[model samples]
Target: MARPSLREKIIESGVRTLHERGYAGAGVREITSDAGVPQGCFTNHFRSKEAFAATILDRYHERTQAIMDGTLRDKGRPPVERLRAYFDAITERLEAAGWRYGCLVGNMSLEVPEQSEVLRTHLVEVCRALTDAFAEAVRAGQDAGEIRGDLDAGDVATFLLAAWEGAMMRMKVDRSPQPIEQFKRVIFASILAPGVKAGSPQ
Candidate 1:
């Protein structure tokens, strides 16, 4: 097999490093060392730490898109139900990780928002992509007559994204899954429209 490209290696190492230690804590030397590549190779692939961080955000975006696609593309399921099921899976993930680390996008937002304009831009895009996906699902549910049309899908999507990130932040601080549970309750009771019930797939 052909050798794994240097860029791929760097990105892989970069993500692992960031996952273990937040952006401010991870360094080029640590990532390159883990990748078994020279530190200078990172510069060949990225201009600076901020640039490398952007690549990590891109990878995160692609991965999150895959998760959303897998969850929402279940044609047999109702749109609102599918969205809730996706959140259920997220809750499980948060608990399984001991609530130590939350969404990478959220973490970056808190850590690097003021330090790096590039990272802030990428983080904003991540939030937009997530909200857009949820908004699309909500729109479909409305057309299906399963979701109420009284609410604005776009604004609701933004609200859900913001609420989720806030919940994850609390989970990280509390080191408990209670915040995740609280989020689920609020999401189902308030955010999903008057009649729509949010829940995990059985």
Candidate 2:
């Protein structure tokens, strides 16, 4: 087999380091070492740490899009169900990871947005993509009359994304699922039809 592409190696290593150590804590040497690539290879692949981090964010956005594409493309499911299922997928992933690693996008937003413009630029792109995907789902639900039509889908999408990120952070800090459960309750109240209660016995 061909040697793995340098770009792929760098991005994979960058994401792994960022996930395990957070942005500020992960160094180029550490990432390259973990990837089993020489330190010189990192410089050859990326102009700087921020550049590599941007590429890492882009790779994450691609992976996230792929996961969501699979979830949202379930043709037999209703829009509301699909939307809920999308959140369910995220919850399952966090639970599986033991909530040790929250979203890379969210984690980077906290760690590097102030330190690196390149990182912040990539984050802005990620937020845009997430908001666009969310708005599409919200629009679908609105068309189906499952979500309130009075809301701006784009704005609601932004809010929900922010809320989800916050819930993930809270879950990580608290080491409990209560934050996510509370978030789900708020989501149900905000997005679902009237008279629908939410969360499991909370």
lDDT of 2 by residue, 24-52 (tens): 78988799888888899988878988888
Look at candidate 2 and give me any clashing residue pairs.
Answer: none
User: lDDT value for candidate 1?
Assistant: 0.82
Models 1 onward score TM values of 0.89, 0.91
Error of 1 at 2 (Å): 3.8
**Candidate 1 residue lDDT tens string, 24-64:** 78888888998999989988989889988998989977887
**Candidate 2 deviant stretches above 4 angstroms:** 1-3, 73-75, 195-202
Candidate models: Cα lDDT each: 0.82, 0.82
| Separate clash counts for every candidate | 0, 0
Q: After superposition, how far is residue 91 of candidate 1 from its true place, in Å?
A: 2.9
Candidate 2 residue 29 C-alpha distance from true site, Å: 1.3
